[model samples]
Target: MKPTQRLISTLAVVATLGVGLTACGPEDDPYGDGAGSGSGGSSASAQPSKKPAPSDKATDRADGPGDCGTPPKLPAGHKMVEPAVPPSKGSLSAKDAKPVCTPNDWIYHGQGKAKYYLFAQDVKAELSTGPGRTKSVPVGQLWVHAGDCMTNPGAVKAPYTCSGNIYDITLDSEGQINSIKEIWHP
Candidate 1:
């Protein structure tokens, strides 16, 4: 055959093979399981699986805050005054506490005392409403030191000092304070 004719034939054959391969569907693909008929063979498998919601109860333990250890003893001369709102549960496990968008919402929503109590000299101070700076605690936990409590009503600024006891708290999905544990106290 002439060289030009041979080259033309080869080119035609390659084009036909390319089109044939391109036409193959998932059903025709030997590597595919056929579950995603129209989608590319591996693309269907590459899609990410749906992640479970953070608030799903099934992911957490059945027990509530009753399972947490005993809370720290109230400071001497410090009385356990009733909080404006009490926490929903006495305690909660780290797994049960859900990440919340607004930590204050969780802090103010529960049935338990709305604020933590601290005693200085003979006087008692409210942890929530008291004067101090407020900052983000670690994940799964919220903290408010007696010094961290705000005395002023406006924006929280620096010069924070550790005052009374440190109130470490946690919350559930519904923004309820599920657990309260005191870390440090005078």
Candidate 2:
């Protein structure tokens, strides 16, 4: 072929290769498992590094509070009793006779302007009365609001049913009291 034609052909091939390579970056892992390993496999399949249990000295020197960040030990004289389950689902009214109130943390509710108090067996007896900060509020008395459904913990956000007593509790924007409806399993 002519010299000029041959030179032009060679330049064309080189230009194509240069453009191809330029389009690829370090992020382009053609054979990688998306982890940049380029091995077409996952590192998660490998056994995790084993960790040693806390030593006695390490446990004692633990810095956090609450029995070394453990559950509180019951008093020696205190007896372990199973948590109680409500007899039924639906609002518990004052006409249902006196409901048991075990002192603990409490959450308050308000409707437009008026406020109300709620008491429960398991829920903390005291909760913040206003937004962001939780002030110590008392559980004066409570009458389960109608239409609330009992639900299991960590389930639906509101209006559900389960074999336990759950409440459709509402709080204001500032964490003020709103309304509460006791939901219990039938």
Candidate number of the best lDDT: 1
lDDT of 1 by residue, 137-164 (tens): 3312222232123232132333333332
Whole-model Cα lDDT per candidate? 0.30, 0.28
How high is the lDDT of residue 163 in model 2?
22
How well does candidate 2 match the true structure in TM-score terms? 0.17
Residue-by-residue lDDT tens digits, candidate 2, 108-171: 1111222223234433222222222222232322222121222233543333222223233444
Worst 10 contiguous positions by lDDT, candidate 2: 39-48
lDDT of candidate 2 at residue 94, scale 0 to 100: 23
Clashes of each: 18, 17
Report the error of model 1 at residue 23, Å.
2.3
